[model samples]
Target: MRHGVQLLLVFLVLVLAVPASVSASSEGGHGGGDSKKKEKSEKKEKGDKKEAGKAENGVITIGPLVVNILSNKGYRFLRLEMIVECADNEAAERLVKADAKEELILMLSNKVADNLLANSGKMILRKELIDLFSKYTGPDKVKNLYFAEFVFQ
Candidate 1:
């Protein structure tokens, strides 16, 4: 009687494990067919579109901004991708019209690497940039400033 119960338990385990293993194999083994690969790619594309929409809700992206750094190396270049956040889309529009990029480029171009390379220096620079952006977009218009890419050499 105990052996019969053990056999029943093993039978139930097999019943549950088969479907799980089959589904796992189907989801992970895209090499099985073109259709699986196509389905996975489609899901990825949908996710990317949703993320892009969310990420730029009240943000303006500006970049490949190249400025001459006031370094001892006879002015090295700093390439940046700046992302600015605002109260809303209207503020973002105002930021663009107020020549925000021009002001930022001018401000950074006048700075030495020592004023920007350290963590504390970067924090100070972020605050300064936010203030400069606010000045350009008008009081209370700009919310935050981010460096998507900061490369100096």
Candidate 2:
């Protein structure tokens, strides 16, 4: 009886250990194939990032800008909300460190006012505003601009 019990234990240990060794060897053989799949996925991720135009670091949403408009009849106003996409983490940090919110407000306000005055109260188009800001900030530095809210009064 003692001899039979010892044999059963040995057999169970071998059965457990054999499958683990087989799986480990199989995994090692397949390791080389994973590199190609990894490379393809990495390439796909790069392409997706470019197409999305997402900031590598993040994005900044700048304000509900309230500007008084120049109108012939009465006091007109323009309110706008804008999102600024920075080139990367460094650029976004620079923007905050420079205290550019006020400066940006002034510059953007001037641009909008200039358009309104030139057209005699014709509001500026979203695309034109984006282009103007891109020019001001340098297209390389600012990835893109988005209008979250726009109201003319």
Which candidate gets the maximum lDDT versus the true structure?
Answer: 1
List of clashing residue pairs for candidate 2: none
- What does candidate 1's lDDT look like per residue over 8-112, in tens digits? 999999999998668757766634555676888999998765332223567877675789989877889888887889887766665555366678788888989
Runs of candidate 2 with Cα error greater than 4 angstroms are 1-56, 96-99, 111-139
List the candidates' TM-scores in order: 0.60, 0.42
Scored by TM-score, the top model is 1
What local lDDT score does residue 142 receive in model 2, on the 0 to 100 scale? 71
The residue ranges of model 1 lying beyond 4 angstroms of the native Cα positions read 1-55
Candidate 2 lDDT by residue in tens digits, 84-105: 6777655544443334555555
lDDT of 2 at 19: 78
Write down the TM-score for model 2: 0.42
After TM-score superposition, the amount by which residue 58's alpha carbon in candidate 2 deviates from its true location, in angstroms, is 2.7
For residue 77, give model 1's deviation from the true position in Å: 0.7
